[model samples]
Target chain A: MDILTISLVISAIHLGVPIILPMLGGLVSERSGVMNIGLEGMMLGGALAAVAVTFITGNPWLGLLGAIVSGLLSGLILAILTVTLRGNQVVASTAINLIGAGITAALVPIIWGVDGTSPSVPKIPSMTIPGLSDLPVVGPLFSSLTAMDYGTFVLAIVVWWVLFRTDAGLRIRAVGESAESADAAGIAVVRTRFIAVMTSGAFAALGGAYLSIVTLDVFQASMTQGRGYLALAALVFGKWRVWPALAACIVFGLADAFALRSQIVGIGIPHELLLALPYVLALVALATFVGRTSAPAGVGKPFVRA
Target chain B: MTSTQSPPRRSRLDNELRAQLAVPSRLSAGGRGGTGFGTFLASLGGTSRSVTAKIVSFAVTIAVALIAALPIVYLSGSNAQVALQALIGGSWGSPQAVAETFVQTIPLLITGLAVALAFHGGIFNIGVEGQLIIGALAAGIVGATQHLPGSLLLLASLASGMIAGALWALIPALLKAYRGVHEVVTTIMMNYIAINISTFAVTTGGPFAAKTQPSATEKVPLDAQLPVITPGTRLHAGLFIAIAVIVILMWVLYRTPAGFRLRLMGANPQAAAATGISLPRTMITAMLGSGAIAGLAGAVQVLGVYGRYFDGFSPGYGYSAIAVALLGALSPVGIAAAALFFGTLDAGAVQLQAVAGISREMVSVVSGLVVAFVAAQPAIFRLLHHLQRTVLAGRTARRAAAPVLPPPINGDNDLISAGLDNKEVL
Candidate 1:
C-alpha cells in the first residue's frame, strides 16, 4: 500500500482508540441504566490528571493510573448525585462536564503556570507483536499501534465477556432493564449502578490518558473538544451494544482521520467541509437512527426503592 | 454553646439532614411542586407569602453556591476572604466595572430566559448555543450589508436573527415532537453543525468575509449600532431592549392562554393531551419562542457589542445561560438577578486572575457549582427548613414558653403544585 493509505489506516486506528474506550465505558454505564453524559467531563479530568501526574512522576504508566483514579472519582460523584440524591441526571452530568473543564483549566495555570496547554510529558511506548511482524501490510498495521491502542482492542473483548458471559453482567443488565424487577430478584440496584458508573469512569479515563500519554503526549484545554459527546452519540447509534458501538466509533474515527488526511493531501474539498463531516454525519445519524433504536428501559430514570 | 451542642440536638441535626435528603425523592415522587428556581420564580411572581418564600430560596441558593466555591478558593492557596474581596471588587467596585457587568449581563439575561422558557415547557433544548450563533450571523450579515435607514436596518437585523434562530430550532423541534427523538441529542448535533457552518462562512475569502478582517464579517453600519449608555464602558442600548424583552416574555408566559397551554403541556403531557392540547404544537411553539429569544441574545451581541460576526465570538454564553436561569430560579425577576450575578462573575473574571492569582475560568467553576447546587435545591431547602425548625424549637422551648407555629414550608411549593409537574422541570 502507498504511504498515504498506510498512514491513513494507522491514524484511524490510533484515533479510534480514545473514542472507543470511552464509548465502551458509556455502554457499561448506560447498560446498567445510568445515562452518563458526563463521560466528557470524566475524560477531561482524566486527561489533566494523566498529564499532571506524568509531569510529576516522570512515568507514563503511573500517570495512566492517576487518570483512572480521577475518572473513577468523577463517576462516584455522578453516581452519588444521580443514584443516591436522585438529582436530575442530565443536570448533574452537565455539572460534571463543567466542573471537569473548570478544574482542569484552573489547575493548568496553577501547576504549570501556563494557560491553554500543559507541559509535555513522557509518552507511552508503542509495541509490536513478534509473530505479527512477519506479515507485509498487516504487520505494519499491527506493529505501529501504541500499547494503549492494543489494550483498547483487548478491553472491548474483555468488556464484552464481562457484560455478557458473567453473573455480574446478568445482574447489571437486569437492573438496567427494570430496577424493581432486579430488586425483586435480590439484586442490589444502587450498588450495581454505582459500580457500573465508576467502571465507566475508569474506561473513559483510560481513553483520556491515551490522549495525553499515548496520542499527543501533552494536555490542552478543551482538547477532547466534543469527542465525549461523539462517543455518547456512537453509543446510542450502536443501540447500546458493545460490538456495534466499536464499529460506530471506528467510523467516527475514520471520519476524523479522513478529514485530517484530506487537509494534508491537498484534496480539492474545502477543509471546513471535511472538518465538518463527522459532526454533520453524527447529526444525520441521530435524526434518523436515534428515534428508531430502543434504549435501556430505565435509562434516565432514578431508581428509588419502595 | 457546649450545652446547645448536646447529643439530642446533634441527633436532631442528623435527622434534619436525612429529612432534607428525603425532600427531593418525595418531590420527585409527588409528581408536582418539584424543587427548582423555576418553581421558585413562579412563586415569586405570586402572593405575599410566596414572595417571601422566593426571597428565602434565592438567598439560600446564593449561600449554598458561595459555600460550595469556598473549598476551591482554599485549594487555590487563597483564603475565602481574599477571593470574596476580589469577586466583589472586580465585579462592582467601580462605575466602569458596574457598566461592564451590565454589558455582560445582557446576553446572559436574554439567553437565560430562553433556556428557562423551554425548560418551563418540558423541553431540554440544549441547542441554544447553535441558535445564538446562527442568529448572530443572520443579524450581522443583514446589518453589515444592507443599506436601509438606521432604525429600519436595526429592526431588520434583529428580526432576521430571530427568524434564523427560530428556523434553525424548528428542525429539532419538529423531530423531537413528531419522531420521538430526544431533543438533547438532536440539539447537541445541531450545535456542532451550526458551528461548522459558521466556521465555513467566516473563512478567509469566504462569502461572508469582512473587508479588513477576513475571519470576521463586516461591522454593522455605524447608523445601525446601539448607542453606548455609558461613557467608558461597553454598556449599550441593547441592555434596555433585552430587559424589555424579558418583561414582555414574562408577561406572555404568565398572563396568556397560550402560555397556560404550554405550561400544561410541560407539567403533564398526558393531561394536556387529554384536554385536547396538541403536544407537538405546544412543543413547537415553546421551542420557537425559545429559539427567537436565544436569537435576540445573539443579535444584541452583534449590534450592541461586536458590531460584527467574528469567528467564535461567544465564549459559551449559551451554556452559561443555563446556570443563570437556574440560579435566578427561572422567574423574570429571578432571571434578571441571576444574569447580574453571572455578569458580575464574568466581568470580574479578569480581575480575579490579576488580584487572586486564579484563572479567569473560575467563573465556570462557580457556574458549575451553582448548577449542581441548584439540582440539589429541594434537599438544601428542606435541610435549611429543618435546621430553622430545630433552632426555633429550641428557642421557643427555653425563652417564651409559647408554642411556635409550624414554620410555613416555602409557599413556593403551592405555586409549583398549581402549575407544574416537578419531574418535567428537568
Candidate 2:
C-alpha cells in the first residue's frame, strides 16, 4: 500500500508538470482576452526547441531557456496579429497551431541530422534535497523531483501573486474588460496585453521543456501530443484562477496517471473508453460548467482603439 | 516583457510584400459589402497609405506567420526536399498531376461553397467536418454493401451521403433554434462524434469494414465509381457535379425566394422574423443545405479517391474548406480556384516532403499563410490603396491620349464599388 501510494503521488507530480505550466501559460493569455488557440503549437515548439538546444549545447538549463525563447518568439507573432494587427484570433491561432506542428517536424531532421527526432541528451537531472531524502512519503514526494518540478510550484505562487495582486495585473484585467476604457485611463492597453501574451510564451515554453527534458527526455514528432489542449481545458475548468487551475490540473493529471497506470498494470479496461474518459470529462466540463466560470468580458472579439 | 528576437532586436524581416486586399466601396472599413455598385470598383482599390506602412505591415504579418510555423518546419529536416518534390510532382508537374488536383478539389469546392453559403446566411456551421464524415460513412455503407446498377448505386450513395450530412447538421440546427446553445461548441463537439463513430465502425467490422485493412470499409461496388472525365488522368465526372452544385447554390443564393429568406434570416434573425419569414424553417433549411453539400464532398472523395472508406478519410477538408470559401471571396467561381490551389498544395505536400527536402507540413504553413493573409483583407486594403489610385489615375491619363492597346481590365475594387450602388441599404 505504501509503495503504490508513493508511486501514485510521484506519477501524479510527474503528469502535473506538463499540465500546470501550460495551464498557467493559458491563464495569462486568456486573462488578457486573447484566446490562444495556439497553446498546442507553443508546447510543440518548446518541446522541439528544448531537445534541439539541449542536444547541441551540453547544458540542459540553456536548453530549457531556448524552449522559453522559442515560445516567446512564437507568442510574439500570435500577439502581433491578434492584438495589434487585429486579426481573427481563432483562425490565426489555429494557423499557428498547424504551423507549429509542421515546422517542428520539418526542422528536426535538418538541424540535428536526425530523422524528425532529436539527438539524445542526458535529462535535466532530478534534484533530491539533502538530509530530507530519508523522510518517508514526504521525502519521496518533495525531495526527489527535477528542478523543473520544483520551479513550477514556485512559479505557480509567483504567477498567482503577479496576476492577482500587482498593478500590471490590474492593467491586464482592465485591458481585457474594456480596451477602450483602459486606453482612456492611459493604461497602454495594447502594451499590457502585448506583455501578457509574450510572457505567456515563456510559461508555455517551460511547459514544453518539462515534457521533453523532464518527462519524456527526448523530442519526437508531434510531441506534447494533446496535453497542451488538455491543459487549456483545465484552465477553463479551474475558472482562470491560478491556484484553482493548479488544483484542477492536478486532478486531471491524476486522471491521466490513473489511465497510464491502469494500462501498465494489465487492467483490461477497453482502450477506446479508457482513452476517452479525460476528453469526455473535459468536454462536459467545458459545455456544462465553463459558462458558469466566466471568461474575461470582451474575449475573442478584437478591441480597436476608440 | 516582449523579448526581441536575438542578436539584433529590430532587424526587419527580409521579405518585401505588397498589401493585396479588395475593399467593396461604400463600406465602413471592415464591415459587410458596399450597398451600391457605382463606386464598388473604386473602393476595391482602397485608400492610399505610405509605402513604408504597407510594406512593413505585410512583412510583419508574414514574418509572424512564418515564425509561428517554424517548429513544424524544424522537425522535417532531410525528408522535406523529397516531400516537396513528390508533392509538387504529384500535384502539378504533369497533366495527370494537374487533373488529379482538380479532381480532388471538386468536392472541396462544393463543400466550401456549402460553408460559404451558410456563412453568408449567418449560420455558423463548424459542424461541416462532422457532417462530411457522417456523409462518407453513409455513402460507404450504402455504396459498398449494396449490389445495384452503376447509375442507381452511384445516385443512391450520393443521396445517402447528403442525407447523412444533413441529418448530422440537424442536431446543432435544432439546438441553436430552440436551446440558445452556440453552434460553435456543439459543432466542434460533433467532430469527435463523427471521428469516433467512423473509427469504431471500421475497426469493429460493422458492415463497412474493408476486408484488407479490416480497419477500413470495403471498397465501393464497381458500379458506384464517380466516372472519370479525363481519360488519362484521375479527374472524375465529379467536377460536373461540383459545378452543378455551384450553379444550384448560385441560383438558391441570388435568384430564389428561399435564398432570399435564408439571407434574411442570416442577416438578422429577429428582423427576418419581423419580415414574416418562418424562423425555425429557414434556419433548419439553411443548415441542412450546408450539411448536404459538405456530405457530398465527403462521399465524392470516397468514391473518387480511395474508392473505399478509411479512418480519417477526410483529412480535415471541412476546416480547410473554410479558407477555400473565404479565399474565393465567397463566390462559386472564386472558391473553385481557391480549392484548386489548396488541392495542389495538399496533393503536392508528399512530393515537397520527398523531393524538396522540405517537410510535407510546409504546405500547411503555406496554406495557413494564405488564409491569414486573406483574412486580414481589410488591413491589406489600406496599405495598397495609394498604389491602386495611382495606377487608376495613370490609366485615365493614357485613355485620354490614345485608344488603349488593351482596355485596362477595370480593377477588382472598382467593380465592387460599382456593385455596391445596385443594392438597397442594409
CA RMSD (A), model 1 = 7.4
Cα lDDT of all candidates, in order? 0.78, 0.69
The segments of candidate 1 whose C-alpha lies over 4 angstroms from its true place after superposition are A290-293, B1-49, B75-77, B381-426
DockQ of each: 0.47, 0.23
Distance from true location, Cα of A62 in model 2, Å? 2.1
TM-score of 1: 0.89
Fnat of the models, one by one?
A: 0.44, 0.26
RMSD values for the candidates in order, in angstroms, are: 7.4, 10.2
- Which candidate has the highest lDDT of all? 1
TM-score for each model: 0.89, 0.76
Residue-level lDDT of model 1, residues B283-325, one tens digit each, is 8999999999899899999999988888898888888888888
Off by over 4 Å in 2: A1-16, A112-116, A127-145, A243-255, A258-269, B1-90, B114-118, B121-131, B145-156, B163-197, B204-211, B256-291, B385-426
Sliding window of 10 residues with minimal summed lDDT for model 1 chain B? B417-426
Rate residue B371 of model 2 by lDDT. 59
What DockQ does candidate 2 score? 0.23
Instruction: Compute the lDDT of residue A167 as modeled in candidate 2.
Output: 88
TM-score of chain A of each: 0.97, 0.95
